[model samples]
Target: MNLNSIHNVYFIGIGGIGMSALARYFVANGKLVAGYDKTPSEITDSLRALGVEVHFEDAVSSIPKSCLNSESTLVVYTPAIPQGHLEFEYFKNNNFKILKRSQILGLITENTFCLAVAGTHGKTTTSSILGHLLNECDVPLTAFLGGICENYNSNLILNGTEVSVVEADEFDRSFLTLSPDLACITSMDADHLDIYGDASELKKSFVDFSKRVKPNGKLFVRNGLPIDGITYGIEDDSDYSVQNIKIENGSYVFDVKTPKTLLENLQFNLPGRHNLSNALIALAMAVEYGCPHRQLANALASFKGVKRRFTYQIKTDNFVYIDDYAHHPEEINAVHQAVREMYPNKKVLAVFQPHLFSRTRDFIDDFAKSLSQFDELLLLDIYPARELPIEGVTSAWLLSKIANKNKQLVSKQDLLKKIHESNAQIVLTIGAGDIGEEVKHIKKEFNVAN
Candidate 1:
């Protein structure tokens, strides 16, 4: 449990966003870091560039010999790794110290003034904003984010360690492990049904997370959530609210009404009202943490946003392409709203890859309704991340349920051709899966044509 005594750190699924952040933290702390991932990715490549050993195979021999010592080495594994992974088995049977990702995160932040952001959605964006705000205010902070922040171009923001900001993930009820000094719940939508089984249980998990805040700590909640806390919302009478919203030159210009005073003409460059809410809560938390309001305003405007959360790959007057990590139905609807609001007269072509089979099956009707809003749709096969496919839960089946006659199921190979055939002015690649890998190619092809 004493992290300072550990000399080496090994990760089982080091390529994951969260795991990679931890790996970077260890590397920055001068640890001998090594790990195994099922596949090589941009993350693994970056880790290797930092001189951490990484391999793709699951064999126990792939582990560095330095990481074999039980006393000096700490082994970390994500829940997504299969139970029978050879490296995992070897570490367990050899009496090595093993910890889940969340446990390690909890231990790292427990002593610091921790700021945790929890929700089914908006965790990454909200935490990233908070981290940027605190860092800009010259707080000694280390933030472990769920996604790479565009401003920093890194998931682990290590300015100093006096304050820690983290995404309090609710996936295995993971956020329960951290006692935060300041925490916020951006939303409590029904999600991760594969783990929680139902919506009420998921709500209960958020409530439990709220209690994990220290007795002297503050908790912030989205205005409409069931929990009682300092509330934030857009264009409403919450404890903290935004009013007089206007979009000029594609950036939101608004005035904030805090519990104490009116802060006017704040600017945020992110697109959606969801993002506006995210920025609001981060501002509220920072203000309560004693950050100067003037510095917080500047930080909010300078935040470029987390990668793949509504990233624009191509933007021209005649054509546009956007990539986003929107897997949930609510997330997709938010993307739809942002796109429609930005380009009201343009025809949008949405290329979507459904993420998990269980999620797709559970929310098929909702997905259909959300995707139906697009002018044209190209549906790819469901990306089965950790589960085997359910019997009838294919993208083709989901396509059939969509009310839009312009929708078709397409293969990745044919995807570009199908996209080129469409006359829509706006293009979006939406998913949390491997669809992100296709962004560079799409951007390159479209940019050349334009």
Candidate 2:
């Protein structure tokens, strides 16, 4: 089970954000790396550019000759990949040493000084910020993030093994695999009802993840989260709190009070109060880990943020365009609050693509209420990431529940035209699906039309 003994690393779903990060990690360490994904993306293309051979097919013949060695090569796959996958089955039938992506990650970070960020939302931003802060403060660490970091342009942040940062993913209960040196649970909202079946089970899972922190390690939880830990929030009584908040030149300027001291006049460029909370937890964890105060503040200012988390695609005096990876009701609510706070009177048009049928069914009412807050709404059919369409679950069905008069369900083909027809000054493309793939076209069309 020693990673040092393996010379070749094969991934069944290499193009996934988390999987690609691991693939990059292996390639950097002088190991032969290759894998398969269901489709090609910028991520996959980047992996190939790094000398990792990636194929899109699911055939057994697609497996490389180098990876066929059962002893020297490690097989890693994401839980999202089906069990019936040809390469997966071949690996199992041959008695190959196969592991889930999380298992491999846990093995890598188990003995390191691990800082894990766990949540239904904000994990990427919080972890990415913490990684950036630590690296900027001259801490030697490796971070495996779930989204592309705009500053680094890679999900894998490479340094030394003395410290490591990771996204403690909750899906498939993956975060439980790691025993972290320090951890944060940002918000334990009800999600993955497909897996947990209800809210109480999801809360229990967070509690389980909380206990995975090392014996002497610290745990940080959001102010209202149902757990016992060091708490953080904005303008609230908590272990770490942000106060004296103000917006200067479109960025948030705030102060954080920790248990020991009040860190004042912190500057963060991201757009929401929720993001401010994310920064606070990152600051608290970094300081608790012994990062210097002045250096941590400097890095927090320079941190660009994770792509697709309230990412501003285009920002101008007369027009504003945002694309966010908010697939849940609570996340969309955060987006709504941010946009309304930033552009008070401007008309906003939201184009949303629900991510999964099960989620859509579970939070149909909440989604309707949040999406209705926009000035105009354009919804696409649900993006079925890993689930088949559920009976009676459809975008049109959800759209009908919205009380907005300006709402309509639009196909991807006609989406640009609909955007052109809308008079909203702010345009948002919100989802956690292939809707992101359309951003290039939307931006190009906007440039051409303007």
Question: What lDDT tens digits, residue by residue, belong to model 1 across residues 72-138?
Answer: 9999999998768899999899999999999999999999999999998999999999999999999
Q: Clashing residue pairs in candidate 2, if any? A: none
The best candidate in terms of lDDT: 1
**Candidate 2 deviant stretches above 4 angstroms:** none
lDDT values of the candidates? 0.94, 0.92
Summarize candidate 2's per-residue lDDT along 298-381 as a digit string, tens digits: 999999988888888777777888999999999999999999889999999999999999999999999999999998999999
Among all windows of ten consecutive residues in candidate 1, which has the lowest summed lDDT? 59-68
Question: Candidate 1: lDDT of 111?
Answer: 91
> Which pairs of residues collide in candidate 1?
none
